[model samples]
Each structure stands twice: as C-alpha cells, then as structure tokens.
Target: EAYAKALRGRTSDHPVALPHPDVTSQDPLSKGLGLMERMAEGFALAMDDDFNSREAIAKVLGGVREATRLLD
Candidate 1:
C-alpha cells in the first residue's frame, strides 16, 4: 500500500498490495504477474553482466507460476 500510495499519480492502482513482508503475492488473480515477469527479465539481463544468475531466473519463474496458479 505504501508503494501504491507513493506511485499513485505515476502509476495506476495495482490489483493488490504487499501488506505483510512474509506474505507472498498480494496480487489478485494473476494481475501483478506481468510486473513480476518484467522484473525477472530485467533482473536476468542485469545479472548477465555478473554471471547470469540462473537461480534468480528460476526463482522468478517460480513466482510467476505461483501467482498464475492463484488465479485458478
């Protein structure tokens, strides 16, 4: 919610908000998964300069899958 409030003008409201750090996927349905995918892709590209952290890519893929599953 804090982030949403901060970006209210710049970005439209997201479907969900991260209230608890421990909780995962505040996105309702698969709404925010696109953001996750974009982040993962960007991270993969950014980390490619270091060592192409495959683990990070895997984690992001897992998150995407998890979020998608929530919609079902």
Candidate 2:
C-alpha cells in the first residue's frame, strides 16, 4: 500500500488473513488477552531467528495450536 501510494498508483486494501488466538480454560470463548498486542508481539518474534521460548504464547492446548498456526 505504501509503495503504491508513493508511486501515486491505485492501492487496494485487502483484509489481512489471520487466525484467532486461544480460548482460555475459564472461558468457553476467549476471556481475552490483548490479542492484537499479542499478535504484533508474535509477528515480531516470528520474524527473528530464534523461537525457542513459546511459554508465553503457549499456555494451553489451544494455545499450542494457535502457536503452530502463527509460526507456520
């Protein structure tokens, strides 16, 4: 989008394809953790070389799945 804007060409806005985070044990749905913030943090971590620690991201079984998709 930035590139197109800079070039003065048409910029199409496409919705980002992303998955939902894990739902906690206490909540049937997600009780919520600043997901957008976590996603941004996850992307930052996903970009770098090492991903040894998943403790923060993987708190439960569903979290493990979420991490798998996020990192994949």
Which has the greatest TM-score? 1
Tens-place lDDT digits, model 2, residues 1-72? 333444464346654332244434333223233343455566556545375356434434444555565445
Error of 1 at 50 (Å): 7.1
Which portions of model 1 miss their true places by more than 4 Å? 1-18, 22-52
Question: What are the Cα lDDT values of the candidates?
Answer: 0.57, 0.44
Distance from true location, Cα of 16 in model 1, Å: 12
Candidate 2 deviates by what RMSD? 11.4
| RMSD of each predicted structure | 8.0, 11.4
Candidate 1, position 27, lDDT: 43
Q: What is the lDDT of residue 47 in candidate 2?
A: 47
Q: Write the per-residue lDDT of candidate 1 for residues 1-72, one digit (tens) a residue.
A: 445554564545555454332224454423454556556666777577676677667667776675676557
What is the Cα-based lDDT of residue 62 in candidate 2? 47
